[model samples]
Target: MLEGIRVLACGARDAVRLCATLLERAGAAVERTASDSADYDVILVSSDFDDANVVARWKTSGSHMVCDITATGPQDSRAGRRWSDAQIQAMSGLMDTTGFAHGAPVRIGVPLTEISAALYAAAAIAAAVRVKRMRGIVQNIDVTLSGCAASALTTFLPAAFARRAVGRLGNRHPACAPWNAYRTRDGWILICTGTEEQWRKLKQEARVPQLDDARFASLAERVRHVDELDALVESWTTTLTTDDCTRICESIGVAAGPIVGVRDLADEPNFRMRHAQAARAMKAHGVDADTYRDVSIFETSALSDALPVAKRAVPCERGANAAPLAGVKVIEIGQYTTAPLVGKHLAALGAQVVKIEPPGGEAARAWSPGQGGTSYFFALNNTDKETIALDLKQESARAYLRTLLKDADVLVENLRPGALAKLGFTREALGAINPRLVYCSISGFGMTSAYPSRPAFDTVIQAMGGLMDLTRADGAPVKIGASGADILGGQAALFAILARLAAREENAGAFIEISMQDVAAWCALFAAGNNSARGQALACLDGHIWMEREVSDAERAQCSALPKAVAAVKLAGATPVMRVDELLQDGDFLADVLSAARDANGAFWPVLKAPYRLTKTPACVRAAPGAPQAVRLAPPAPARAPVPEDRPA
Candidate 1:
């Protein structure tokens, strides 16, 4: 949030623009100028490592957060390296975990690493803000794109950590079978049968007799014989149109949705609701609807409340547990991937998060790779959180939450636009009740956008923002393997939390909004902005080979620099075009992966480790989250106590 903070943005790269844009969107005042770094609360200098010493001093003086974004971390041998997104992806070993199992190992369509690094840098800046305010210590945040990209390889952690071999699962997630897109009579439809009950429902629709075979009764068996299982599913999917598939699946209580393009969002209930609301407003004004700009950006609120700095100075140290965010307290109400992941990230960092869910639990709990009605991903993403069943539609529940927010540092939610406001949780409303609260709202388009009411599902954001178009190299647009749009939005929300939390002092708190669609568009800033900056489109040539080595000024000046870099890597006999699945087959790559692993109680474990480790306050996943504990909340009293943060960290 850094609402009153000013940021000095220096550089002309997509990363710089993205960094500044994110800060500005989160309420920071940003100025594009290389002058007077002393005047700003944060300074972002691009491609100029020479200022490292000056930046380091600025941090030490407890002045501003100086962030350096580059291709590699300061500890890496390739510090000060310059690279394109394709180059970074090709060499990071992460690309080996993406794309088709047998096809070319392609990069995620957008500048994933750069944007992800920008996000990391932004969060670091926010974290620095918190550190500076809470402890009078200025922390320098250095982020490398390659490192942030690798940190996001959490989906690969389950197998990577267990000393088991793992590879690309393609469109099918490793956690669940039938959790992929299937062809229909008209187009494709995404569906999942994560639990036995969901499978039974589909069986009811198919009328397929003998599906109760012992071999397919359990999840392990279904995954082991996924090929055969999918064949049976195709038999039904191939017979129905996309709409029919969705309708039938919903009718039978299965998780399913039509695979639609971006333009289709306008017709969805979410966006159509916006249209209807706008029409009504126009009618009220007695004006022609066509004569007005869409008044879809709903009005939100903000406030400042003075919270006495309690004497409880929770040690801001890494502690023996290695949790950087040991004392952070977060309360969130989320249903799916985007918002849940944000809470999950904080939880992983040792924050005590309380998730408010419906009595039936969140929909994600039933997503695939589920057992006894709970999803594996839901379990993992919700790790380190406490869950409370609350019917928010009830006034009693609202009162309970208001009491909880009294001392909680952050509150995150992803309900439909205006859902919270309708529930009497507007920015102004919440701020009046608990001024030190940093409220974060993550949605599909935004809290207030032209299409404020439109659905912001991962697929919709991908399709509408053109991520699908950029991903397909030689065919029509198709979704990337990962739920990138959701992931990006989650990351954005996490970044916002850091800044907003930091901004919360004795008297002020901030309101932050993140749009999934906006984050999706950031992925293409490089491809779209390159031409305007250089008067030529960026060309990756083969789009395969990449160099991980540092590029000197002399080499960078050459018109043949890219080719030369490619040649250097090829000379080393590297397999530049290997698919992600192929990497597991390489003895050398396998060994390298093993070398990075740590031994815990005689078992080898590979962490989803971040690139730049904090020297004194590293982040760690200390323990697996179990069933959440419940708390009894009532009307607030004047005495403020910390959110119940009882955890291992």
Candidate 2:
């Protein structure tokens, strides 16, 4: 999709390498050296790069799309502290929300914050290119690891508002019962039952009559007695091998998968399938990874060219303070986090999004820790949009959806590979309805995947994507504390959509298929080549602090003599590890990252702001789930003649 585009990646070795890998995967011609002195379309620089003269020259050019990837947000850059995934994860609350209830906070295996910042950088660059094409606006983008990490806290931040401490639940979910990893004869298997029907199926599959107890009947009741529920479920699981457990769960239509280790990830059918497709994609561009060591992983630095400022073909439809996506209209058919998150971001940037939910609402509505009949979990992703409930099984609802699509600019969905098609809204059908539509689908696998019907919860993807293995604690695999697969995949989908939007031709539609597994593999590129390190946690007088590099016994002893903050301040090359609760007291973090948003119940809560900063057309959160009066979309235009088949991007 980025064919013929040139990108310069120069900065920290690891960061630049990752940026180059991603740009190359997108078909861009990437140059890894800053000394090339060649004009480029985009330049990505890391904060670690200290060449002041080079930075000054690039900034003055005003012709290239420059993106700076930093450890802190624009407001907090003055602190100038170096960071690693573990420290950022600690400060962002992701680490504190993970691990065993009684144990210390654990780090995510991968460099999550850096990876997230990179994705945002890539998306922002794509957005800038689109703006330049549409209105001749050139913008510099600033992406921060802290900003991205705060964004992922959407699912956990609401609890802080309620004065509830959201501690680590380990493999157990905070919301539902039978939603944890259980031990089997050979290894471990994860079982997740979200609905009542799925819970019944799990019981039947396990032949566990004890699950029929009244205390474990309702969702709330099961959660209240989750410990007993887990004990009962594990009894059945322990009798069988991991494979036996998985087979029975799948056979009964329960969401379950074996907890995969690193050595076994490459052998998984789904991972192998995704790797094969990636190889072919890269090979078409004359780039190929010789082995597993090659598959890899965004960001911005210099502006150089002066494309003539062009007049928009269409009249401006937004106010003077319009956001980046001010006039775009989007239709979102999403459940849970992946596609809904894309919609949330698009809405935050001022797109007019209408979310289509089932008549009974999406499954996420029932997730725990909610307020006034609304799930806080659901509110996090469904913000800044209007919603319509439809029973797609009914022709009338489908007919309404068809009409809604007639004037839509983008359609985002994360349903199973063929679920939408089965309802008669295939890519071809969507293209026929709106030749200008950007149809994007985020799925566990591509539409042509070998395992179309396999269940793909976040747990399953982490296990199969080699994340669990890399995030092991004491040699035992564990999923990342946060929904890494879903968030990363959603961000990737957004990037593809923005790229397609920028390269759009009149009456030309594009189909974007993003596989969660593929995104996981791509993000793991750097981490896959390096040995997994969970980071060192040093004991302090009052609490603990995290450091990515190994700390000797003497260093630990020195730090242990002081409080966490004092230790961080006194110890050379140390910073305080923060928790989600600490965000409430962080002035700088609160200023740029957190915003107050009212939920459907009129209760005010904290939510994350946009993850990137665009100088000209910045992203803003104008409204949330409960707010009314979003950007009023234009009335449906008269249907136009259908165009040729839309091609996939």
Among these predicted structures, which one has the highest lDDT? 2
Error of 2 at 371 (Å): 5.8
Give the winner by TM-score: 2
* C-alpha local distance difference test of each model: 0.60, 0.72
| Candidate 1 per-residue lDDT over residues 1-649, each given as its tens digit | 4787788887544566677777776678999865653478777765543465665566576566666677765555555655655555665555656555545454566677767777766766776566555555544556667666554544554443334554555456565665656778987676766677877778778765545677677888778777777777877889998877777876766656655443343344433354465335434553331212232122123543334323223335543444556677889989767778788777766678899988667766665444445554565566557788887787778888888887787788988889988999877687767666668888877875665434445655665554665665235345555567777788888886765565544435566777776565445434333422111111234334433344444533432335534644534422254333443454533432222322222332233344333333444444333444455655545667779978897
User: Which segments of candidate 2 are over 4 A away from where they belong?
Assistant: 13-15, 35-37, 208-218, 277-322, 360-376, 504-507, 532-534, 552-562, 597-605, 627-649
Model 1: what TM-score?
A: 0.65
What overall lDDT, based on C-alpha atoms, would model 2 receive against the true structure?
0.72
lDDT of 2 by residue, 1-649 (tens): 5666788888673445555566676667888765556778788886544464675567568888777777776467433455666677777777776666766667787788877887777777777766766676666777778889987876677677566776677777777788887889998888888788989888877778888899998999999999999999999999999988888887777778777654455555666665655455434543223333344321110111122222223213444456667778899999888999999988876788999887667776776667665677777788788987777787767778889898788899999888998999876677666665778888876666657767788877776666776776556677787888899989888887776556533325566778887677655544655544556667787667777677788888899898888888776656566767777888888787877787566677556778888877888765546522223233455789999898998
Each model's TM-score, in the order given? 0.65, 0.86
- Candidate 1 backbone overlaps, count: 5
